[model samples]
Target chain A: MRAAIPTLFILVLMILAVSLLGVFGSPLLLRVVIGAMINLVVVIGLSIFIGNSGVLSFGHASFAAIGAYSAAWFTLPITMKKIFLPSLPAFVLSTQVGLAGGAAIGAVTAAITAAVIGVVIVRLSGIAASIATLAWLAIVHSVFSNAEALTKGTSSLVGLPIETNLFVATSAALLALVVAFVFRFSRYGLMLQASREDEAAALASGIPVRQLRLFAFVVSAAVVAIAGVLKGHFLGILAVGQFYLEFTFLSLAMLVLGGMRSLSGAVVGTFAVAAIGEILRILSSGFEIFGVEVIAMPGLREIGLAIMMLLILLVRPMGITNGRELTLPWKRKAANELPITNDQIG
Target chain B: MNFALQTAIDALSVGSIYALSALGIGLLFGIMRLINFAQSEFVTIGIYILMLSAGVWFPLAALAAICVVVVLALVVERMAFRPIRTADPATLLVTSFAVSYLLQYSLVLIFGARPIGLDILPELARPIVMGSVRVPRIDIATIGATIVLLSAFALFLRKTRIGIEMRAAAVDFRMARLLGIRANRVIAVAFAMSGLLAAVVAILFAARTGVAAPTIGLELALVGFVATVIGGMGSLVGAVFGGLAVGVVTVLLQAFLPPELRAYREAFVYIVVIAVLVLRPQGLFRGAAARERV
Candidate 1:
């Protein structure tokens, strides 16, 4: 509980800065920051599970899809449902649960899905588990794509109330950060990390690896699901494809590129990648340098970000933060001055 | 009988391509424990090369594609993979992704996102009609190429010096190195073999589809990865069997499922994958591939 201070402090400063930006900056900048904050929610959720357990899940986004769709299903106007999702069950089609209720539905749906899936997924480890999660993602996406009556098939599920403003997004980000911070320093987190470091040894010491991983999986799923709902309302639309690969890669890239093991890494990586991506998008939108204006490059933003991620990986494979939480000078110990090793970071 | 024949040919041709790609993935996973997601990029580059040289002699175009893919594969191994040789599986997987991301979008930068049509291997489009069934010549060629490649690969692994060293290394990397197997040489050869197979897979894909795009490799590689897992990660025979199994099962589902469920074909396929994993975590093969040590 005490160790949550650093995480809370950092988050407060970040939120304050964002609030100032919202007040003074352009709407586009505010939107970008809010978007980044929504992404921050998902990335922090990923950090909770992937960071602690050392499992590279390619399927967390499926849970996000579940959450986002739930939000849309519950919140979209009944009239819109009649137009777009007439096949929906009468109960779902008739009610507009509003944003808060829809977010609850989203959270519950994602948690239940994760809990059920977590039973089988936690039984496996390493690459097999990775593959299993991918299969999970494929199955979810397939259902979402084909289940027309429910998901509107591949068509965009629109008419979401634009309720996720900066205040909502920032508060959620701060809450997610605190939850992650507490979870990381908790008893289960220690046990999970022990298993991550050496499953055999952890088992020998009486750690229940499966149950621990399941706990982390469910918790992270719930957090990420909330992010998905936030994102759905933020964008004022929900599309199955949006929650699939783009956020999957973006969050994973941020997690790994920032430092997979550290909370600070998650914070830093999300901002770094999001900022770089935002800047690249502006550059690709074409800006005048000195005198002449360069024409916009259609795919330069993604290509440039990919190259930047590669270079960063090449330079710092451990990630930008190198797995250690950021510590202030007065509070930092001499041991912190020593080069941090892999075992010490997460 | 005609339906069976058509489905058999369909399954075999598609399965052969999956088998070839899976073999490439399996070979690298054998030694490095690295699931090279970038293998698909090699296939993409191969198709792109063939597309660019479509007006050239078919054999020349194939040669150039194979050479370019092989060089690119070797470069990926040396530059990205080699440095992370001893890293954890997650790091390796992520780095492979980075390499894949780089190669894939770089192609987008150079070639743009538009799909390019290749007229190379149009002869393979010719069909053979027998009684009530018609099969494309490319189907036969695909099956033939797979059999030839698998056989040749088996012979190389069994009889050739470098191939034996590769096998030895695959079984036990540190022991093989201590036994004087040049790790670098063997790994490079593995990349070369994977690249060569990717090139063939590329031509086959191009012949079948008549178009080349960046995402083609990703589409194929995901299936190949599944096939590799289904066959057992590092086993060659299992990869072939797994690929064929996936192809046959997939086509069978597509052919036989109710129309409403037909569009959910991928869902069914992945469901089966999950079921297989739950039942047999070691895959269909319990062979001597390096299991993650506890």
Candidate 2:
């Protein structure tokens, strides 16, 4: 558990910085930081499974979708539900819970969905497994977008209480960080990392690859689900498209940019991408920097970010941190303790 | 009988387009173990070229599109991929995704995100009536194009030295390299072939949809990726079969499911995909190349 200290300390400091920004920054900045925090939660959740198991998942956002919709189902006012989702089941129509209760419901729903779906998913590996997860995302998107009564189909489900303030988002991020950190050092995590390095060897050593992958899948899904609930509440609305391709790509890019093999990579990657994205967004709006007028072009932001990501990957293929956790210099080479190497980072 | 014929033709047309795209993905996967998500961008560029060169003679315009896309594919390989050619499969995939995003937004910058109609191949829109069934000419063209391409590709693989070398490289790159097969040349040839296939898909797709957009090829490439996976990665024949299966299932679901559930047709199709994977985790093909060494 002592190994967890440095990782937790670094994460806590990051969270404190965000909290300070929320307290002192302008409302617009507050909004940006809150959105970034939500995305951070999702990326952290993504790294837990993708980093540890070395599997690419394109479907984690589906759990986020599940969480958002279910949270909306449980929390939306009965009057609003009757107007927007008249065909919802009577139980859901009648249900109206507070934000915490709804988040619980959302997380549980996503966890159960993942547990059922992960059986087939964890059995496969490499690109095949990646494609399977993509298929699952499609399945979820199709169902959620088509289930008009439950999800309002393509329309936005509104009236979610805008209760996910900076405090809530920061707390959730902290929780995600703690959960991920704990899981990374757990037995299941170590086994999954072994399998990730060399599946045949890991299996030869009698590691339950499938089971560990399943556990990671479920755990990550729950974390992402919580982020989804946070996002829905933050936006005061839920839309199927919000949890689809764009969100998946953005979160995955952040994880890969930070480094996919370590918790610190996830956190640093999210902050870096979010900060760059914000600066790009501002520049795209025709900001004047250094007395040189930057022309307004909405498309330039995406292109610029994509180019940056490409350049970064070309320069540092393993990511910014290169899969190593950030540890204090004075604590280096403490012989008996885990040194937070790439192999032990996840 | 008429409805059955129409559905069959529809399925065939869609299946052909997907198969063409999947062949591109499978070819690259065969050589580099890289799933080129940017294949979609290649298709999109081809469509854009076709749209812009509308005033030119149709055959010449098509050739131009093919040439441009092939060149673009080669450039992308050298600039974006070749540098990190030895990276792990996941890293390779993420890089391709970045390239795809870059290409897509660049298209958006060139031609705004909004889709524009393309009037190329207007003649293919005409319908041919046969025994109480109306078959669109484009459907026939798509199916014919796919058949010709597949046969020609098979012949090339069987009869040519480069094709044989490509096959050997795909089967075992290290051993093939040790045996004097040039890795760079084989990989480049694979990218060129995939580019050619993407070009063909772009024309057919444009003719069918009558529109050009930055996102037109994204969905196509995604379907191709899924088909490549279900067909068994690195197995060319399996990719075709997978595309056919996905297309048929999609058409059948849209035709038969209740209107309320019809919108969930994609869900049903993917459910079948999951089922296929569970039954055969390696995919439908048991190719020696796809099997795990252990």
Candidate 3:
């Protein structure tokens, strides 16, 4: 009964969002909504590892990149894809599968890469882990940038079918949210959090810390791959640089700004930041200040984002949602009766 | 042989700059256990300062640039870092990232998106011809400066009472406090020293490339970071050796690889870094137990 509230609310929200997209029918708004939804998947995926395992990963975007290129390579029209994969398998060449197949393949590829890299990376803890993950990001970036035959090098690969509509994106986000929530409540999540909070104690309690981290890392990579597939389709293009430092930073910012530990926080943070970013773009196009032409406001979005991040860090470091999910009144009533300890709250 | 020698010299020059940059990053991490993502911005800040003060005497401009970076570092420490020193390391990491983005975009706001070339001293920028091979004078200067700064830094850590205290604090802040070492003062000094190293690297990097962009620091920071990891995280001497090794490997890859595949140099270097890390997670050199001071 307690879990039913969130599921109902999510269903309503998803229906309402799709209805709005259908009613408005503006390509730009559709793109923005789809982009936000896709980002929700990635952010929630990151939450599994970063939020639960308490290890920061700077290389998640690399998995996203792998997912993106993989999908593009498999799905794009063979004639248009001649720039990258000239000699493709007839199966990949003749048949263009739906978004699900593309996304699934992307997830598998990213998961495999993460599994290989996580073996070494998950062994390190704290700042060392952070640095090692960054190294992984750099390594992946170099590979994508140089592998012209596969990624079309730095050039934008065009001609992806515009298959990622409101339905696909919303479905992916819902799936990601469900998965993330399930993980959050499971024993695996509890053990990962315990390890994060007190590694030695958790180890003393017989938890295989490395194995748990590796599990979270692989799962996160797979989920983020779905996000990457959606983003590629939404944009109708893929570039190596798009998946590099800039997107990595943006995704990290969203996770941090949204409460890292909560599924709802991931959703809210993605929409909020996406809206903020879009508004900044609009303002930079139209508004002016102190006789300065605002349309040419260089790096305005980044500056605004930085300021927002700084304010959030200073004022409410736990994030806007603080890991609390918004649910139906009945759930709230039930939750009120429970003597909630601080341990269960955050 | 000449090509190999030239590559070796070029590697040494680049390695020296990386070593300088990594020294700052390594020292900061050693003391606070906080990876300041904003350290790259300090390098960018120093370069911008140098560019702005180009009309002045070169040495004076350099000094002013270092001072500016030191002051900026102190401000960041006070405003961003000090408040969150007791928080989780993740919080500090995120805050440092915010600071980095803030600095990068602020520069973008002020300077626009164009890359600016620093007007380095002509003598420093000129190439020093030697037999069949020629190396830039800035390379020589970078090597010299790195050696002097590292030596001075080692001496500071060994001979000075404050240095001892800072080392002690780094080992364990609570224990250092129990022993009456001022942790705040030690951390501040680390920031200042980090700033100073950033300034030195900035000058050398700008002189070598003749261009300065806000984004350049991120790449240099990556190299420094890899080197720091390859060198034991807390060991200063290890950072130097790791920096040199990374530089040599990158140069050797470029020299040996076919022209068509030369662009893969960085990728190869990253692979090497990953392999080294997997083989020796603790790094090549682990420092002996040092008293915690900072």
Candidate 4:
């Protein structure tokens, strides 16, 4: 499955599906598609570490926050920087790289932060590791909220280019999907998966489990940081609160609901949740059905989404696809159909 | 010296909340191997109930709130956890997150996002002057309540048959079941006791803050969860100690750090947490759950 066309086919199919909407869908509908694609990019990045390595992370949103803010600082015009962040260093005040250069800077910065955090966190396993990741999230949120001179606390950072469209978002998501698929099949990824399945066995086989986890952690951080760049650019503003609890849980839920293990799971989960959310959002906006106008209902979408997630967990704990990779009809068997052992995931 | 004493009392009161929540969480982890993120919702629900019944006699309202919380906790056990008791830890953790999401959003729908004000615990706000240092009565009351609850809890665990069984279950759940411990009964009791702990935290926290909101429990629960982790998961005493340590460290850092850096206090506190986790993964107190055989 790693080398086959099934994975590629799924990625291309999702791109085309979303791109079709880009071309013909109403402007509001197009915005929804682009937003979901950006979410797909983040969710896929998260899956590369969480799904393969079997570690749950509540901190990846912090990486996204870091990337968004870094891009804001680097790409916003020098004039805007002076108005928003006068305390920024002289060079930073004058610096103005475009989106690509800004994203690269953000990704590298996030990757470095991950390299440091992962060294300590990867040493722990199971629920302890999960909790530690949460601690990292809380720390990032507090720092970003209070670092007034640098981040402007909770005030929105306006003036970033608002140019993210369906095509750009689809391409970014496709790039993330390809990178995640390749990494999942890489030697280090396989070794890390082995460690996830049976740590003692992996250790016995002389696999450097911690190092493999660190590798995935850093790469995933860079990928998520790119999602942050797109998000900041798309929204035309940056706020630390935007990257906290809601984003973290929503992304994690998508990965969990879609299927945690396979690339298809990430795409399916993102789309499934996004679709359900869209339907509910429209319904909440006082839609007319069968010549009867239903009044708008506040907070119903969130409530509906939460109920749906819980129902899914109860019915199919392994998620919608049960961690199976997408297989084309031409393929003989979906690659890696090994039974998902209970104790395997960290 | 006055400042040190001031910080100590402040930390003790603050830590007492974390310790109480962590204690409930730690108890469940002992018997059920669950992190119970929704335990915080128990606190939020308790406070909301308390707020609604504010016109009632204080003692009666509190009693009613406690009962409601206990029933809710038991319901969560019966509805969500009992069915998937055999699932892997990962599934269980994710399920807990789902449960949390359900409770939190439901709360938002019921009670709007805005924080509602109430002077819930005016008595606890009175200053207790001593020589040169002044402390609020709530500080003393918080510490006193913690001591009484913990002492009562320790006695219950040590002196009762169910308590002994719970300890046995914590050490070796399978063996305890083999020895005739009723699994459902024991698990229900764990949830009930943890609910009691959460109610206490809610009462104290609401008394101090005088406001009620949907996400109230989330922040406190996170603090308590952190305390449980640092104290050594599954160790009751460790959870209490860990909670106090976190509170003390937070206040001390705030007091001593340069004013310019004070805003980043949580960031500094988490750094210490990461250091502690890296240095002692089993935590400061090693319990049955921490004892892994290679």
Candidate 5:
């Protein structure tokens, strides 16, 4: 019954999304939903590492960039693939493996990279780990931006088959949620959480602290890579800018704002921030305050959102929902009655 | 030999600017154990303020820019830091990043995406020649000014009551509180000092580059951060040395390496930083015990 609730919720949301797409049928809105769903997958993955582990991994977006580029290299049409690889493997070049193949390859590549780096990075603790990961992000971004032959430099990679429709994206998001739920309940997840709360104690308790962290980091990278693959297919183009510091900041904001510890919080945060960002962009384009345009205000949305984050931290530092899940009450409580636990009553 | 000399000189100039900006960053980290990601935004804010107020006297504009950044830093401390000071250090770090984005984007909205060139202070930007190599006068000024500012800062730290308070706070905030030192005030001052240093660095950076943009802060911050880690997290002297090392490495790579791979200068720098971090995580000069806080 406990497991069914989350699954049922995701199913309902997916159905609603499809229904909304059928009725409204707006391509732009569909596109936004697709992007949000893809982001949701990566955010859930990040929650497992950052939320449960109590560490920030700044390089997660770098994994996303790797996934996007790797998938694009494999799947984009030959004519549009001149920049990255002039000649590809016969299998990759000849066969137009669709979204699933691209995403899987992306996941594999990201996981491999993460495993290699995690061996070194997972040894470090606290801010050192954060700095190392941040450096990793910068290094990957530099490679993506400068490797003109492969990534076309800053130029966007086009000619990708748009295989990431709302359905695919919604399904990926649902899958991500399930994975997050399973991980949260699993013994490994409990061990990882214990390590996060007290590393010394966990180690004394026989937990392989470094190995656990590395495991979480690799899994997170793989999930983010899959998100990147979906994002590339949905957009039908990939650019370095999509996965750089700006995206990193946006994801961090979403994670922080939504309450990082819960799967539902990740979803709510992604959707809320995405919606707010869209509305802000629209306002900036059209709305003027006292003859001064709002969008012209430089970093208005970011500043406003940042201020909102500050306020949240000030008043309720734990976040909007304090890492709590939203659920329908299974047992009913009588009106005007105060329920008590047996221990308290005794 | 001439090429090497030129590269060294060029590196020194850039290194001086980095050192100036990094001093603030190092101090903030030393006292609060938090990396102020918005430190770069303070540089951007300073540059834009100078540009916006260029119609006034150049010195006055520079002064106003510094003052504005200091005030902004204080505001950030009060609104952002004060609230989250009790939260986990990771949360404080993320908050700082959010503040950085907010400041950068706000500047973009206000100033537009175009680069703002501050040509009003041409007198401060005149070039100086040394035998075969020509160096910008502003570069010389930046190096000289950094030396003067740092010397003065060292003196202040050695002599002043507030400086002692700041040192006490940095040594141990809890102990400082027990000793009746106002840790909050000291932290606020540290941020303002950092902002002031960022303003100075921005003016020099803009003078050399001829333009300032919103994105400049992030790149410079990365360099400063690399320098900070290389120098050791909380050591001001280490930051200065680290900045010089980074600048020299970049310039030497540009000068000595084949033309084709010059663009890989940043990557080379990253490798060096990572190598240094792996080998000596406490920094070359900082003691092993310094690793406990950062």
Candidate 6:
């Protein structure tokens, strides 16, 4: 409970900052903040599993897709759905729910799907588990892309209400952060972290590693699912392509660059990446540097971002936060988590 | 029956391309436990070279592509991978992902993201009919080239000194090092071999599609990665079989699934991959070196 103070403090600070930005910042800044918050929610959700379990998952975007599509089905006005998704099942076609209700349903749908897949996924560890998740991602992407009757195939699914303003997106991010922080400090989280450190040892010590992994996976999926819902509602449209490789790469890069092992790292990484990305976008459109008119080359934003990530990794392989939670400067520093020395490549 | 035969031929050809790509991925994983996602970029770079050299003599263009791909593979390893060689698999994978993005967008900067249409070997696209069975010439060439390459790869591993060192290193890196095997040489050789295979895949893939795009190699590389996992990580033979299995299943799915379901063909194949992982977590063809050190 005492540790919660700093965490809560940080959360409040983030919310205030976002609210101020929402009020005073330009419309474009608010839009970028909203987008960053969505990504922050995703990174936090992903950290719940990847940070605690010491596994890499490339499938969370699929869960996000599931959430977005589910939200679309429930939230889209009935008359509009009847025309756009003409072949939606009778029950779905007739259903129309508000944003919150639809988001709740989407989260449940994603969690249930994660539970089912987690049974198969949690059995493997290390690189094999990572690959399995990738396979899962491919499977989901293909299904969604081909399910024309339900998802309209590769085409856009519009008509979702744009209810995700800065406040809504920030609330979602706050929810995700609270969930991740609580999970990380809980007994289950401790046990999962133990397993992440040494699976064989954890098993020997009577930890139910696989079951804990499943729980984390489901929880993470549900959080990312909400992010998916927010993205759909915010944009008023959804597409299967939106939740594929590019999104996956962007989110993962954020998680990794911030430090995958701590909730604070997840938050920090997302904001850092967003800021750098925005600045690069500005520079790409030509900016005066020291009174010199300089127009950056095309693709410079992507190239620069990639280079920054690589350079960061080269300097601090763990990440910017280096696997430790953030603490106020006046407070005593948190203990550094033991470095995982799994030298075997797998 | 002739139609069935034609379908079978198509499957083999597709399987051959995947096999080459998987072989490249498997070779690198065996030595370093690195899954080189940038191999996709290697394929892309090769295709771009081919596109640029379209009017040049065919053999020269082919040779130039192969050389550049091999050099690129080496440079990437030195610059991006070597710094993090001892990092965990997750870190290594992410690094490769970064390298992949870097290489891909570099191409986007050099040549716009749009696909360029150019037939490297237009003659190969023609179909030949034998006994009422028609087979595309590219298909025959793909299969033939795969067989020749695989045979050459096998002999190289068996007969060459560097090949023996690579095998030894894969078996036990620390032990092999103790026994005087040069880690740098083995790893470099593995990268060069991977590059060679990527070049072949690029040429064949471009010939089939008649388009050179930055994203063309993405799907192929993904299939290759899946095939490597299904084949059993670090196992050369497993990579080959995994590649073949994915290719055949994908083609079969496309042929038999209803028109409405055709687009989901790759999904079904990946489902099978997940099922394989669930049943046999060690992979279908387990590598010689036991992965679990504990």
lDDT of 1 by residue, A311-333 (tens): 78778878888776776545545
TM-score of each: 0.94, 0.96, 0.90, 0.95, 0.90, 0.96
Q: Please, what are the lDDT tens digits per residue for candidate 3 over residues A1-346?
A: 3464574377348535743764486777777777777887888888888987878898899999999888887778767766557766657766666677899899999999999999988878765677688888888888888887777778888888878888887788788877776776577877887787677888889999999999999999999988888889888888888887778767877887776655566776777788787777777665768987656568777877777777776776666666555566567544222221232100
TM-score of the B chain in each candidate versus the native B chain: 0.97, 0.98, 0.94, 0.97, 0.94, 0.98
Determine the TM-score of chain B of model 6: 0.98
Candidate 5 lDDT: 0.76
Which 10 residues in a row give candidate 6 chain B its minimum summed lDDT?
B85-94
Ranked by TM-score, the better of candidates 3 and 6 is: 6
Tens digits of per-residue lDDT for model 6, B1-294: 987898899999999999999999988887888878899999999999999999999999999999999999999888888887877666677788888888888999889889999888889988998988879999999999999999999999989999888888877777888889877778888898899999999999988999988888998888888888888877888999999999999889888999967777878888888888889888899987647776
Runs with alpha carbons beyond 4 Å of true place in candidate 5: A1-26, A82-91, A285-300, A325-346, B123-126, B287-294
Which pairs clash inside model 3?
B166-B294, B167-B293, B168-B291, B168-B292, B168-B293, B169-B292, B169-B293, B169-B294, B170-B294
- Residue-wise C-alpha lDDT for candidate 1, range B117-196, written one tens digit per residue: 77777778989988779999999999999999899999999999999998887777777888888888999999999999
Per-candidate iRMS values, in order, are 4.0, 4.6, 5.1, 3.1, 7.6, 2.2
Each prediction's whole-model lDDT (CA): 0.84, 0.88, 0.78, 0.85, 0.76, 0.87
lDDT of 4 by residue, A1-346 (tens): 4545676787679767877876898988988998999999899999989988888888899999998898889899898899999998899998899888888888999999999988888999866787789899989999999988888898988899886778888888988988988888777777888887888889999999888989999999999999999999999989889999879888988998888877788999999999999988988788889999888766667878877876777787778888777777656254564457764211
Candidate 6, lDDT over the whole model = 0.87
Q: List model 6 lDDT by residue over A74-146, tens digit each.
A: 8999999989998878998998998898889989999999999999999888777888899999989989988
For model 1 the TM-score comes to 0.94
Clashes (candidate 5): 11
Flag the better candidate by TM-score, 4 or 5. 4
User: Which regions of candidate 4 fall more than 4 Å away from where they truly are?
Assistant: A1-4, A287-294, A329-334, A344-346
> Residue pairs in steric clash, candidate 4?
none
Native A-B contacts reproduced, model 6: 0.64
Ranking by DockQ: 6, 2, 4, 1, 3, 5
In DockQ, how does model 5 score against the reference complex?
0.35
After superposition of all CA atoms, the RMSD between model 2 and the true structure is 2.6
lDDT of 5 by residue, A1-346 (tens): 3543654476347435643663475776667767777888888878878876777888899999998888888888766565446666656666667789899999999999999988878877776677778888888887778888777888987878889877788878777777777776567877887777677778899999888889889888888999999989987888899998878867876877777765556777777677776666566555778997644454666666676666665665555545555544542221101221111100
